[model samples]
Target: MIGAMWKGMSGIYQQDRGIAVESNNLANSSTVGHKKDQITFADLLYTNGGMGHGVGSQSVSKQFQQGQIVGTGVGIDVALEGKGFMVVRSRENPDEIFYTRAGNLVQAKDGFLVNQDDYKMQGLVPQSRLTSSTNPADTMFTDEFARNIVSTNISNSLGRIFNINAKTTDYASSAKNDDIAQKGDNYKSSQSKINDVDALREDYINKLKEYQLTPNVPEISSQAQKSQVDFSSKISSLTSEDNKLSITVGNKTFSVEFDHDGNINQDEMEKLYNFLDDSGREKYGLIDPSSIPTQDDIDNMPITTPEEIQAKADRQSLRDNSINAYSSAKSLVKAMQDLSDKISAYAGYSSSAKSGTLEIEGLIQGKEFKISEVELNNEKINSTNIQEAIKGSGMAMIDSAKEALKQAVEKADAKYLEITNVLDYADLNTIGMTDLNVRLDVLGLADKDVADVEISDDGFIFVKSGDNKFLVGRLSTASFRNEQGLNPAGGNLYSQTDLSGNPFNADTMNTIKGKSLERANVDYGTTLTQIMVYQKAFEANSKSITTSDEFLQTAIGLIK
Candidate 1:
């Protein structure tokens, strides 16, 4: 009877242990990364031929099966897929390392990457400083180039004006020479008129001598008639010579027909002189007759006076200025070209390429990632569209250049706008990513602090600092050879024991970020059925004990 009671007590103890295991699994059903425990029972040593002593509570093992993966758009909420645990260390105790399947991460005030329990994640040390090679200084530099171009253009025009002014001075000097030649012609005509008058006086004196010597009216009258006949002949000859003097000068010819009896007919001479003078002046570009000096004033006149000379000199200076301007323009253009190259370098653009495509490369967690085209969301950008924006005059060109620069920057923005870290098997080229601080603070030139953090399925950690993003680190995952032998530590963590094999790196294929944790493997319905069975088994054991006790009591009563 005592042995039956002892057996009943052992059954109750084992059942209680089973109930405890089921209750624990049920209690942690909502816990993240929680694994359910299963209780195993073994029969005690056999005492009789067909009877066993009692039940023994065997080992309690955990079911390491995967739960359904759910997506939570949050960047920091990380979850494991098939088999792995994130390695983390307690901030309070830096040397203590714990393995967890939960991936909810955040940046502590001290800038350490931590999980929900303030456990620091274990991974490669993050790069301290990073320089984003995006073109933020392009606008300022382009404006400078435009200003130089404007100055160059002005100088080039000045050079052209200077050449025109030199030609103008030559024309003015020619007019002056024409005026002097006209004056010389008038002086020669006056000398010829004086000589003709002298000749006439000599002829009169000779005729007087002839008349005095004869002292006869008849002789004088005959002589005077002869002289008059000769004079008329001379007059005819002079008029014919004067008509021949009228000749074609430039494009037109004119005739100055003198009177038959002439003492050098002033009207005919004046007409001839005027026609030639006007033609000469017209040929020299002296179209303003009023501005031209007459034959009488030509000796003292000049085509360009001292003031006009100074004006020509001033024009020459302007020409020189224009030349200087042209030279400056050349220099400015060369400088702008150099500056353009520098700007391209600053913004990670290659001017050497004939095509508009520029390679945009950035570092994420110290790994270099490159994107061939400037694009976002699969949209390719046209360089023509960007260049089209840079049109117009000097200042307008500056604005245009700025617009072009902005478009170039947009290319960088598009290439790395979102925090993408998952390695896509479909497209290998689309594997680049950027974090909040890396894009906003570093590349975007923002100054805001970190506001959030995110981890991808591939274990890439991104920190959001004040609307900016930075690739802080990559989360390292570990896999144990004997996961079943892992000792459960409190707070959804597991510790490696001698029985559990040392943790090794987990394959990335099984890891997924932005997913819900694995649900507990416990089935409440099964646990309830087992509990009922245990209750019946305990009742049967107790009944055996009670029947044994009653039989003993009846035997004692019969002996009395």
Candidate 2:
């Protein structure tokens, strides 16, 4: 009776614990990234043969199955679709690392990415500090920004020098202004200071070229070419008969010939004017007849003034001194652009050349990857000739393209350094060259506040401000060999234990970006059913104890 009572008591205790576990699961069913908890029961040791022991709680385990991933439409919110947890370190205690499926992240006051508990998220360090790292994009951007600063500085300095020279010349020639003497004194001091800076012009240029700043040269040259107006088109549109010039603007065409040799041609000029007036060309606003120069207007115009002449002469002088600098800069940009174009063309060709399908397990084939075999047209001589003219086997096409691109870029790079020397000697140069406006979207200025942040599927974090986009860091994910072995270390984080193998970076494909979250894996119906079953078992165990007590009471009464 005592053994039976003890066994019933054990069953009651175990069932009560089982009920608690089910209740906890039901309570946390709505929690984000929550995993369901399961309680296992085991039979206790039996003493004698053919005798069973009461049930006892074995262990409480977490179900590590995947949770529901739902979209939240928030930029920083990330959800793991597969088996991985985001790695985070306790902000207050940096050495303590925790893994979590809960990705409700926010930027803390210090700009570190943190979860809801303010734990700092672990990520790859920003690439900017790793200068030796092999990131081609980073290299390109650093070079571009450096060159931008140098070029802007050079342009401003040249402009300042030009203004100073113009003013000094005017002061020396004629002392018209009252402040001329004071200005002269200032000019002397400014000129001395400028010359000192000018001495280092070579050094700045060398630094700019050392960065290999050539990405925008091609684009700038193209814009410059477009800005050069074509006068030939206008000239071609004009119809001149005898001594009259006729031009069309919109739908109206008017012809007028000037006969200024003071002869019968005057009558023709008059006749042309009468015809235009009769056609109502001036009244209808087709053309302004008065704007066209009459003989009187031409003769009455003032001759060039001494001031104007002086101005023109000064401009010519400036141009003469600076032409070499301008030409050199222009040449460098053009070469860089040309090289860039060739690289793009060859890169495309190489891709096309290698795109053809090949049999992997087939026998040896002759004339593999022949560019001649790839054709837009069968009869085109140039197309066929290019493949023949290219000196190498078909397999070498991509290699050849890569080599050409590399050489072109390098040659342009060499010429870039030469520009600094040219600019050093060209003292009177003004930066009259049009702005390149190279849109290097990757570069960001330091100390600028971030406008927005984005997380990519590949775990790269990008921060943007206006036109600038910065690569801040890369988010890292951790995966475990035995995920269930992870212990719940409060605040929705898990701690690694001996049972779980050391964490490794999660497979790349497991991470999903954008505004998404993983929902809890708890099943309400199943938990509710578990609670009911445990409650019934608890009542039955209590009844068995009650029955034993009743039987003992009856035996005591019989003895009485």
Candidate 3:
């Protein structure tokens, strides 16, 4: 009777525990990155005679199931479409790391990552090689990582733009600035004073640089013939008291300097500096008809392409022309060699005054003769005659050589025009050289060309961003696990958790739909089904308890 009582009592306990576990799971069904918990019951061990299985405590085991993502426009709100747990700091104190599926996250007053639970988030600090170690901070960003990411262009609606650069020791967030990209914590070199070694090395390097400067090195002109207004270069710095002439010549800008008084030597620098307007004439939209040195100016100078001066060329062709001329000349070389062989025989011995049947490869010395198969007599012969044989394989070699020259001139003139025509455009020295490469260089090609971008500065961003030929938005995607585990704090964001794993930050995940958020993976139908099961299990356990109590009461009554 006691054994039955103990078993019945344990059953009730298990039922109660089961209800709690089910309730908890049902409650968190909407939580982001939340994993579903499964209720499990254990049988209690019994020692009485023919002991029966007695229910122990019911416990819930969390499932590591993945969840779906819901898209939201919030940039900070992250979700995982895949498997992984986000690491979060404890709410009581964020320093302590704890794992949770609840994606509930909030921006803590501190700039570091945080969730709605006010738990600090943990992510692997990028490893750097400033010194050298496997440690994350030791990891240096690759050029690709340095890409400027412009999240949004400021519309008429201006909001706080935060510039967070992982490059510095501190994180800075600005409320509202014109340029967010440049607002990050400034990263200055280590403050350790320069030691003897550093100073000495620095000085030595400067000396070497001075030597290598070659300021007087003749500029390698890529100009083609017929180029006018032979464009040269001007050197200047903005800090040198010079009216730093950052002029955009033709869609390209170049900076030049003058003197300490912010004045330039008019005679030497005026053309490169004074020619452009100070109001960013070419670069900014303020000017009408930007890009000086139009196409016409190139046609009249020492800067024109070589073809423009082909009429003046006397010796031969340029690089490609020379190479081809040599090649064509090679094709005729073998023919010339054969003619020489025949001519040598004829020179050695004419038809020998013997109509003895000689086949004549050439006519020499004003005598027409058949070749009597002359042989080398180990004696020297005039090379001029041999050359004539090669030309037309007829009269003396000298005469034949003359004719070959005529053919060569004719063939080369035509070929020269064709090849030089193409090479001329590419040559920077051509008279009509547009200096397209330089144009790009001076026009801020390096700074203006960007992939993903954000504009936070004054109204300048929206206007400046559209000026260049940049792509729409950088392709990107974000991934997370256990949508239910995620605590969908307000803005589509889910905090990190042990079960959910860390968020796989999607920077151009090669997915579409930028400025949008992924939807949560929670299935409403499935959750409702789970709810019904939980209710039924609760009801069944309740009945078991009630029945056990009544049975006990009967047994007690019988014993009395």
Candidate 4:
């Protein structure tokens, strides 16, 4: 009876412990990153050939099962999808490190990323300090701790926590500004300082635009020929009775002849004037008869005396002989005009006679044509005197302009390329960490206000500032070889032990879900059911103790 009573007492104690464990699990069912506790019962001792003495609580261990992930739509909330824990260090104790699955992170006032308990998250950083070394390595840090801790002494290790308080002005230099200024004259005198990443990008883009040059050389669709000559002046000095001027245009030739008295042939002159009038009537729908006086009009004029008659006759003779030359110079303006009209009709060219000079120009820019022959009084004029023969001079001027434009573009493009190379190096050397401010500082975007924050499926954190997006940092996770061996450090945190081994980089299969959190793995239904079972066992143990007491009371009464 005594042994039975002792066994019942032991059972009662074990059941009570079981009840407490279940109750704890049920209470923490909604806790974030909470794992359920499982209690195991065992027989205390064996006596009398395998007869158990009593039941006792063996152990209470965490289940470590995966929890349900719920999205909270928060920028800093993160949930682990696989087996891993986010590495963090305590704010109160810098040397103390803890691991957790909770990802409710926030940026502190000092610009460091920390969890709800204000524990700073650990992550990798660029090989060099944010303010130094243009080239940085992409590798893991030897020390497990983050380099983000603010200390006056610089460490030799590359690992650091994130600090994102850097600005574009931190990296800006007068030499870089001078590189951009060399691209164009507009920027040479104004060396503006870059205040932010967006401003730096804008400056580079503007400098690039200066080098995007397009040649403006005129398009010559067809060849052209031009000639200028003092034909009227040369014709007036004609001393021969048979003075002839001939010009050829395309397949047609026009020739004019002077009579023995050095006067243009009257019949030919009258025919030329008539042809012009007829052409004007056909083309412009109007006849210009008043352009030249007709011979019949002079013959019809009246005369009063012999002297007057003689005077009229002399005037008529002079008019017929000189063709009404300007100021009695006897220029062949009328002859040249008539001949030019004939040539213009056959060839794509126009000619005019003024002040005893005749000028001809080809109407088409690049159409191949020529003034094949030009002769006056049986003498050939030199080709050098014509403007078209020296067209090389005009072409040389155009070539010079083109060369200048080419050199300007080359210079601008070279500087633009140099600036782009620098940007590429900066991007390649950049490293990521968990802290938003540190990430911004490394990316030279700390001066800009963040518009949005996003975490990629691959663990990259990006922040938007105005119209530009910058990579702030990457979330870091640690995995253990024996997770169950980890020592619970309270507040959903665990510390490394000899059995758990040191924390290492997580497997590639592990991923992160942003804007979400892992719910406690405890099952309320199972916990409640276990609690009922424990209650029944407790009652059975109490009944056994009561029954033993009743029997002992009966024995004592019988003996009395």
Judging by TM-score against the true structure, name the best candidate. 4
Better of 1 and 4 by TM-score: 4
**Tens digit of lDDT per residue, candidate 3, span 1-560?**
45555665666566656656556656665666565556677776656775666776554545555565565554345554444444554557545444444443343443333656565555322111112111333332223223221111111111112111111111111112212221111101121111211222232233223323332333221111110110111111112332222211123222323332322222323222232234212221212222223233434435267865662242222322333322322212222222222222221111110111111222221122222222112111111122122111111222222222222222212110000000111111211201111111122222232232321111011112222221111111234555444443332234556665545543222222222333334456765676576567557656666777788789899999
Candidate 1 lDDT over residue span 83-162, tens digit each: 77878887676667788876656666665667678877776323333222123332111111211110000112111100
Arranged by TM-score with the best first, the candidates are 4, 2, 1, 3
lDDT (tens digit, per residue) of candidate 2 on 1-560? 77778889999999999999988888877777888888999888877796877888788988877888888887777788877888888767767888888877786655667889988877653322222111233322322332211221111222110000000111112222222222211112222223322222332234334223321221110000000111111222222222322222123332323221312233433333343333222221222223334445444545489876665555555443333222222222222222222221221111110101100110011112222221111211111211222222221221232233222222222111110101121221221111111112322323343446666565555554444344455566778888888999988899999888888767443856557788888877888899999999999999999998888888899999
**Distance (Å) between predicted and true CA of 304, model 2?**
44
The runs of at least 3 residues in candidate 1 whose Cα sits more than 4 Å from the true structure, single-residue gaps closed, are 48-50, 105-107, 125-447, 465-468, 555-560
Indicate the residue-level lDDT of 325 in model 2: 28
Shift in Å, residue 128, candidate 1: 7.9
Query: How accurate locally is residue 553 in candidate 3, as Cα lDDT from 0 to 100?
Result: 89
- Between prediction 2 and prediction 4, which has the larger TM-score? 4
Q: Write the per-residue lDDT of candidate 4 for residues 14-49, one digit (tens) a residue.
A: 999999988888888887898888889888779879
State the number of backbone clashes in model 2.
3
lDDT of each: 0.43, 0.45, 0.32, 0.54
Q: To one decimal, what is the Cα RMSD in angstroms of model 3 from the true structure?
A: 30.3
Better of 1 and 4 by lDDT: 4
TM-score of each: 0.46, 0.48, 0.33, 0.48
